[model samples]
Target: MLRYEMQGGIWVYPGKGGWHFITLPTDVAARIKAAMAGLARPWGSLGVTAVIGKTKWTTSLFPDKTTGSLLLPVKASVRQSERLKAGDAPIVTIEIAL
Candidate 1:
């Protein structure tokens, strides 16, 4: 099962990108259930760039210890948004193990 966090006026989503709630009207809970499935896809996870976005302007994941892989740069527009700087505040917490 997926969780839909009711944020702002509309339903915001989890991860670093995309709208949170496709549309979970109160009347029919079934629709919300369907939307949750879509939101929970493997593609729904925060991309590699997003992971790096979580810890920028601070330090690297391996400071003074370089790795072969390189993280993508956060787009200027995204850097200006809440999710990139709000830690996990803007993300709807999902309970995947449950």
Candidate 2:
């Protein structure tokens, strides 16, 4: 298992109820690509357990071609639980298992 903790700002997608996301740092994304690229699922999504504040959930991290980073989707439930909104920067912990 590998664990990473980082802080990033949340952003909302333009349409379709506005999906929220947090982009992983470029360095961290590169590290993950090196270590876990073979473990990725379809669309380059990697399974992970994410925690923000006291809220935790299982989800997938998707690679972003535009930014060369990884994107973590922040579900509405988790956002409500963590009291987070788009534009807020929060410390998040993600655990990946092999």
Tell me the tens digit of each residue's lDDT in model 1 across 1-98.
34333221223335577332212123223333334444332423311112222433221111111222111223335445534432323322222212
Q: TM per model?
A: 0.20, 0.95
In candidate 1, which residue ranges exceed 4 Å CA deviation?
A: 1-65, 86-98
lDDT of 1 at 52: 25
Clashing pairs in 1: 12-20, 13-20
Candidate 2, after superposition: displacement of residue 51 in Å?
A: 0.6
**Would you list the C-alpha lDDT of every candidate in the order shown?**
0.28, 0.92
Runs with alpha carbons beyond 4 Å of true place in candidate 2:
none
* Native-referenced Cα lDDT, model 1: 0.28
lDDT leader: 2
